[model samples]
Target: MCELLGMSANVPTDICFSFTGLMQRGGRTGPHRDGWGIAFYEGKGVREFRDPDPSCDSEIARLVQNYPIKSRIVISHIRQANAGRVCLENTHPFMRELWGRYWTFAHNGQLPGIRSKTLEHYVPVGTTDSEHAFCWLLDQIRERFPKPPKRQTTLWRFIHQCCEQLRELGVYNMLLSDSRSLICYCSTKLYWVTRRAPFTTAKLKDADVTIDFRQETSLQDIVSVIATEPLTHDEEWQRIKTGELQVFKRGQPC
Candidate 1:
């Protein structure tokens, strides 16, 4: 299994604090150290980085830690290979172009026999069940609506339906984004927290570090973070129920 991290903010924000806590789990606090990757959605563009090595020791991961690239939506994953070989090709948060926008996906569970499922348009370059499922999901969406739908609810419900079908196969906890909205689905576990005005200092669960968000944020800034588990030791996190599909926009669940 892997671990997932995501962010949706009303204003552009860097995920440095949360990311640092997660990076420690890549090898130190957790066992998902096979590979790691992250994607940041900046308007219509995406900044992504991937490495087929333990994030705890990877130089690329270090660079990501040091850089404060701000984005409205972000998704990240650290893997402990179950369905694919440990290599660059199998590393996630995978990205693809859809409806003229870059879409990012990352999964934290295994889907046995997922490759047997048929795909029409999108084909995976990697041999992981996670990637196969992602391609299949996008293909289904493309088939359902040749162009973007008139209503966002239509697309959002369709995504939930697709995720439900995937959940029938196996554990399907995931984070997905189309550079506009962040979609999260839970088969087993996922937690989230929202921080806005009157923010307080939060301590990391995996690292001995703390951040006073009040000093770094404006009164209007609303930020949300989602992870496989609670990232901060002091703050309360809301867990997504099993079989739940949550859509987040501008730091609030919709």
Candidate 2:
């Protein structure tokens, strides 16, 4: 199994606070320590960092923790390596180009026999079933709609349907995003919380730290965080039901 983290914000925001909690789970607070990766979407481009080492000990991970790379949408994962070898290419938060836009994907569940599904437009660079499923998903989307759909919901619904089909294979909790939208699907566990005006302090469940978001954010800021588990114990996190799909854009659900 693995852990997933995502963010969608109305304004460009850094994920240092949330990421600190998640990185602890990579080896200290949790058991997923095989590898980790993160993708930050800046406008149409993505700034990505990955390492085939425990995030708790990786120097690269520390750099990311210290650097405030702001983004409107982000996807990150810490892997335990159930299906693939512990290598750089086998890391989660895989990326690919589709419809002339870069899409990022991260999974927290196993999808056995996912490779048996044929892919047309996309191919996996890694051997993990997660990556194979991502390619297959993109393949299916490309087949159904050669170009981006006119109505955004049309594509979102199709993605949810595809996720349902994949869920038949095994647990399929996932986080996916283009630069504009963050798509989350829950199979067993997923939770989300949005912070807006009159923000309050939030303390990490994994670390001895607290952040008063009010001091760091403006009244107009709206930020949503999605994770396999709640990062902070203080905030009232909303759990996503099994077999349900949620889509977030500009920090709000759509």
Candidate 3:
């Protein structure tokens, strides 16, 4: 299985600290070393970086770790390659356009017989089952709503239903975003943490790094991070319940 990382912030925030821990797992501290990719949603646009090489040694991964690209929503994944070949096209954090907005998706587990599903609007550019499942999901969303819906909960509930159906197929831990809200669904393992005012210091589990968020953030900042496992050993991360779908907007679970 792969690993996932995502963030939703009330204000634009950088994910450098959490990403650093995840990068070390690509080849050094863990086993998900096939490839890695990340997407940052800045306003209506997204800044994406992908590498088909092991993140521990990839120059592009190093650049992303150093670059402080701030965004309100973000999604990332590190692959272990169970379905598709280890290549750029098969990387996670796949992007597509839907309802005039760029939507991003990253999957952590394998789904069998996903290719047998039909798609009407969206299609996969890669051979990965993750991408195929994404296309099918978007197609279901678009088919139900020819245009974006007025009430947000309607779409949210529909997404949860769709995810539950996918869960019936296999483990479907996923992180998806539309540059505004992040939808997280857990079929097995997923954990999250939220930081607010009077933040404290956190120590990374996979690297020799520590951050005093009190010095780096303000009293009004609210940031939430979700990962396959807790990135920091000091923080109290909450586990998402199995078969639960959580929608995060403006850094709060909605």
Give the C-alpha lDDT of model 3. 0.93
Which prediction has the highest lDDT against the true structure?
2
lDDT of 3 by residue, 32-54 (tens): 88999999998999899998999
Q: What is the C-alpha RMSD of each candidate to the true structure, in Å?
A: 0.7, 0.6, 0.7
Model 2, span 1-254: residue lDDT tens: 99999999999999999999999999999998999999999999999999999999999999999999999999999999999999999998999999999999999888887877998878788899999999999998889999999999999999999999999999999999978899999999999999999899999999998999999899999999999999998899999999999999999888
Total colliding residue pairs, candidate 2: 0
* Model 2 / residue 135 / CA error / Å: 0.3
Q: Where's the lowest-lDDT run of ten residues in candidate 1?
A: 108-117
Model 3 poorest ten-residue lDDT run: 114-123
The lDDT-based order of candidates, best leading, equals 2, 1, 3
Error of 1 at 168 (Å): 0.7
State the displacement of the C-alpha of residue 137, model 1, in Å, after optimal TM-score superposition: 0.1
| Model 3 regions more than 4 Å off | none
Backbone clashes in model 1, listed as residue pairs: none
